[model samples]
Target: MKKIGIFLCLIFLWSNINASAITYPKITSQGAVLMDINNGKILFQKNGHGRYAPASTTKVMTALLALEKCKLDDNVIVGKNPPLEDGSKIFLTKGEVLTVDQLLYALLLHSANDAALALAEHISGSKEEFAHLMNERANQLGCKDTNFLNPNGLYESKHYTSAYDLAQIASNAMKSSKFREIVSTLSFDIAPTNNHPEIRHLHNENKLLYSQKYKYPNADGIKTGYTIKAKHTYIGSATRNGKTLVVVLLSGVKGYYKDA
Candidate 1:
C-alpha cells in the first residue's frame, strides 16, 4: 500500500509539471501568434496560418516597401486618388506636397488611409501596381498565405493574411533601423503641408506603446487594424532583456490590446 501511494504521487507531480510546461495564454482572438524575433521561433499560436482580412495592419508592409524604395526626404506630390480614399486619413488633398518621412509618420502612427495611398502611388504609379509589389515582397519574405489588394488594407474579398505571415512580414520590417524608429515612435508632428495649413499631430494607435492600462513593459510597435468584417487586428513588438518578441492577433472580438 505504501509503495502504491508513493507511485501515484509521483505520477501526479509529473502530470502537473507537463501541464505547466505547455500552458499558454487564453486569448479571444480567432488567430494569434507569438514569435521570438531573435530566433524566429513560434512560442505560441492559435490558428496562426488561417487567412483573415488584415485591415490597417497592411500598412506595415507599405511602410516597409516605402523605406526600401524611397528616401525619407523624398518629396511626394499627393494625387487625386489618395485624397478620395475613404476611411481614416490625414485629409490629404490633391496636389499636397509632403515628404516620404511625413507620410510614413501618418501611415504608421495615425493609420491614415490617404497617406498609404499616397505612398503607394508614389512608389508604383498606382495602388493596383503597388499591391503586386506587396505580394511579391510577401513571397520573398516566405509569407505563404497573404494577398494584398490595397495599400490601406481596406476591406476587399481577397485581401487577407494569416497571423504567421503577418509576423513574418513584421519581423522583416523590424530589421530596418528606419522602420524600427518609425514604428516605435509614440507621436509626431507633420508640419503644415502645401495643401493643409494646420499642423497635423499624429498619435500612435498601438496602445501597447502608450496606454497605462494596456502598455507592455518594453513595447515598441508595428501596426493595428480594424473593419466591420476584419474585426480587430494588431501586430505588436517588444524588447525585454535584450530579446525581442512579436505578437500578432487577428479577428479579435474582445480587446486585442489587452490580449497582447
Candidate 2:
C-alpha cells in the first residue's frame, strides 16, 4: 500500500508539471511564427510558410542592403523628387542630402517611403536595380518565399513573403549592431536640411515599444505595417534572460500588441 501511494503521488506531480508548462497562445493573425534565434528553433507557428503581403516589413531587407552597400557616413543625394506614395513619409524634397546613417534612422523609425526610395536610388541607381539586390540578398539568406517589388513595401501583387521567410531575414538583420540600434530607437530628431527649415521629429510606429498597458519587457525593434489588403503586420523581437526571440505576424487583427 505504501509503495502504491508513492507511485500515485509521483503521477499526480508529473501531471501538474505538464499542465503548468508554457503553452502557445491563440493569435488572430492569419500567419505567425515564433523563433528562438540562439539555436534556430521554431517555438510556435500558424500558417508560418503561407505567402502573404508583408507591407512595410519589406524595409528590413532594404535596410540590410543599404548597410551592406553603403558606408554609414556616405552622403545620399535625393537628386529627383521621390515617387508619390500615400502612406508614411519624411517629406523629402528633391536635391535634399542626408547621410546613409541618418536616412536609415528615418527609414526604420518613421517607415518613410521617401527615405526608402532615396536609399534605393542612391545605392543602386534606380528602384528596379535596388530591388534586384534585395532579392539576391534575400535568396542568399534562405528566404525562398520573399520577393520585392519596391523598396517601401507599397502594396504590389508580386510583393509577398512568408512568415517563415521573414523570420529568417530578420534573424540575419539583427546580427548587425547598426540594424539593431536603428530598430530599437523609440524617437529621433533630425536637424533641418537645406531643403527643409524645420526640424523633423520621428516617432516609432510600433506601440509595443512604448505603450504602458501592452509593453513587453525588453521588447526592442522590428517594424509594423497596414494596408487595405494586408490587414496589419508586425515583426517584433525581445530579449529576456539572455535569450532573444523573434515573432512574425501577418494580416493580424486589431489588437496587435497582444497578438504580437
Candidate maximizing TM-score? 1
Q: Give the TM-score of candidate 1.
A: 0.91
Give model 2's TM-score versus the native structure: 0.90
Each model's lDDT: 0.87, 0.82
lDDT of 2: 0.82
Which lDDT tens digits does candidate 1 get at residues 8-93? 22233334444235546577888988787788978778899999999999999999999999999999999999989999999999
After superposition on all C-alphas, the RMSD of every candidate to the true structure, in Å, is 8.1, 8.0
Give the worst 10-residue stretch by lDDT in candidate 1.
1-10
Model 2 error, position 19 (Å): 13
